[model samples]
Target: MTARPAKAVSRRPPRPARRTSAVRPPRAGRGGPRRLYSRVRRAWDRPLTAYYLILGGSLLITVLGLVMVYSASQIKALQSGLAPSYFFRKQLLAAAIGGVLLLAASRMTAKLHRAMAYPLLAVSVFLMCLVQIPGIGVAVNGNRNWLSLGGPFQMQPSEFGKLALVLWGADLLARKQERKLLTQWKHLLVPLVPVAFLLLGLIMLGGDMGTAIILTAVLFGLLWLAGAPTRLFTGVLGGAVAIGALLILTSANRMSRLACIGATDPGPGDQCWQAVHGIYALASGGFFGSGLGASMEKWGELPEPHTDFIFAITGEELGLAGTLSVLALFAALGYAGIRVAGRTEDPFVRYAAGGVTTWVMAQAMINMGAVLGLLPIAGVPLPLFSYGGSALLPTMFAIGLLIAFARDEPAARAALALATRKPVFGRKPAGVRWKTMRRRVARRPSGER
Candidate 1:
């Protein structure tokens, strides 16, 4: 009976062998650096990332600048027998007006921007020409780059020149590109380079080499963005350098500035006084700085503590951490600008964004480099971080331009539309909820009300 039962074995197939050598995919969020990189990539890939970066970075820089201006200018204002908040109030007012301009610029269409380009260029040129006239031009710190707007109000046409160049150059390049004329080096450099050099001449005539340098950077940025050939780009660059060197060599003041680079001593007539003190302020700042408004350099020790050397005062009061934060903000703003330029299909947006980024970044580097004693003192105010209303106004408007371009990105536009469609997160839109409630009420029995 047992043998008979054994002969009746089941016909089920043999169990398949498990493949022990098979590799398993790594789990999500398990690998350390890979996970972090993925997260960063995702965040960077978000539609509104560049927009938020531009908006948040610019706002933070501006707000922090206002705070620093108030802090750094208090001593200077009191020394001049004015209220401590005088400069602060003026800057705040300019910021407010600039906010309105920024809003208007951001809301305008691309066509409107292109339309305004010529008008803005005209106004800027008119003002720049006006700066050459002694009666209307106001000289500050030995540079005749400002226009007296009557009373205490002053405007720097060169500051506006930066914006004008960005807009006009962008529009010019975009149009030429559409016409397929950028292939020839002549068409690329013709009006653009000549006009830029003209602006540089105007800026230099006012003895504002700093502004000239920034404008030069913007010019080159435009040319490069327009895809200028290597030889042409280098030729233009060489000409600029030679011109800059000639100017520096010819002037006593410029020579003095050139000699002050990396100087450790005050030298004769305290020529290096500002530079040395700037180093002192930064070195004394240690890691975290003394505290807000606690800078010793601002108490008559440092020159232009609220403008050219503002970074030094910031170093003294806020320390390395604060300075790094400012640097990071600028870096983020620049990176965002580059991202916007890179992602845009529109040539105007690309050129405009790149030009603006180059302008701001070049200026920041110059100011910071001068403060750090790494370069000659260029007498340029730190963009957004300085106390001058003229500088702040134009820079803020430029920031608005960046925001506008960032908003114009296809992904950014979609994100903005979705955001407007649903203003709140994690909940149905109010309109949708309201409609649903009305439908439910209409479907209910009268007694169920």
Candidate 2:
């Protein structure tokens, strides 16, 4: 019995240990997950559709500006006993500064910009007031609208005023929309009318009719976007026309300027001297142009060649073809800006974009119209191409804002990726590999469960 018991106790080589499945770490060299993740991130950071149009238009205008600046300033510089590059140098410097501002503006967040709206408006108002102070404001070309800080550095509050009004209007409308209170005129008028009148009044005090008109256009565009009542807007428009007409009629200078709008021979020493010369410049440059730097009108004939009359310089140098090209550039800008407003899903962003676009396009049309004698001279400079620091800087910043909105467009983002073909961030994520595991789980028998 003992022998049998001992034999039974003999350990059978611990029944060859039952094998159990062990979870294995992910396979090596399978970078498929990492690669897939990167692809997605790159797509998300891409820009929107309107960006290309803006970029292209900006480049063309800048190049044309450089050429026109040289052409327009050659005679003025020589006459002033300064270097032949005087105006060109100043223009280039302004363009450089404006370009920096433009880039910086493009990177700003919409929220940050909206926050800045009120402060900016306040500052602009203060500046506008400063321009009225006896010694502080310098009268230039019969308009007491400029504040000369120092050598070639002047401050035109009206230029910044346009931006302020836009941002303010957008902020106001956005707040109203948020509270569901924008439907009534009272709610809208509380913030809109007073601010607009204040802005318009300030510019009017300086006798800057051009800036005032642009401001009015911006206001109308914003109100339309804000869904204001049609009757209210029509009333506002009619009132604006009446007030403008009264102002023009009351001022001797303005009256004379208006009377000369279509006069062929303004006669010597008339208020129409500048307008007449502008036409002469355009007429001299038929289709092709007189050739770059060969403008006869810039020789003390066309006053303000580098400022309010820059478009005439373009015609004198680049000719009708060049003028048309300039127009095309502006058209491109309008198209891109309109596209940004259309594509944005956010209401504040859309209104802001539209307002900025309308400001520039309207201003451009006004400047061109004045040059063509289709409208009274408003003293507005052409965007980017004009050689004024104040106008150029704000305009460039506005363009940058438009570009920022365009960058947010979906198609532009996609195109950015396609063009660069590089990841904007570190890498995108690869989807989890659950298919194989799911199949394995399904294969398990119900009994096992």
In terms of TM-score, the best-performing candidate is: 1
Give the per-residue lDDT digits (tens) of candidate 1, residues 287-327: 99999989998999998999899999999989999999999
Q: Which regions of candidate 1 are displaced past 4 Å? A: 1-31, 423-449
TM-score of 1: 0.89
RMSD of each: 6.6, 14.7
Show where candidate 2 strays beyond 4 Å: 1-48, 414-449
State the RMSD for candidate 2.
14.7
lDDT, candidate 2, equals 0.83
Cα deviation of 335, candidate 1, in Å: 0.2
> Candidate 1 at 194: error in angstroms?
1.4
Clashes of each: 0, 13
- Report the C-alpha displacement of residue 315, candidate 1, in angstroms: 0.6
TM-score of each model, paired residue for residue: 0.89, 0.82
- Residue-level lDDT of model 2, residues 1-449, one tens digit each, is 45543445765566777888988887653578676677755753345436867877986897688778787888888888989998888778888998898898888888877998999999999999999999999888778888888886788988999999988889889888989998888987787878999999988988889889999999999988888898998998899999999999899888777877876786657679899989999999989998888888898988889778989988977888999999998997898788788778878888899999899899899999999999988888888888777888888888888877787666766565544533238432232122332221212344342
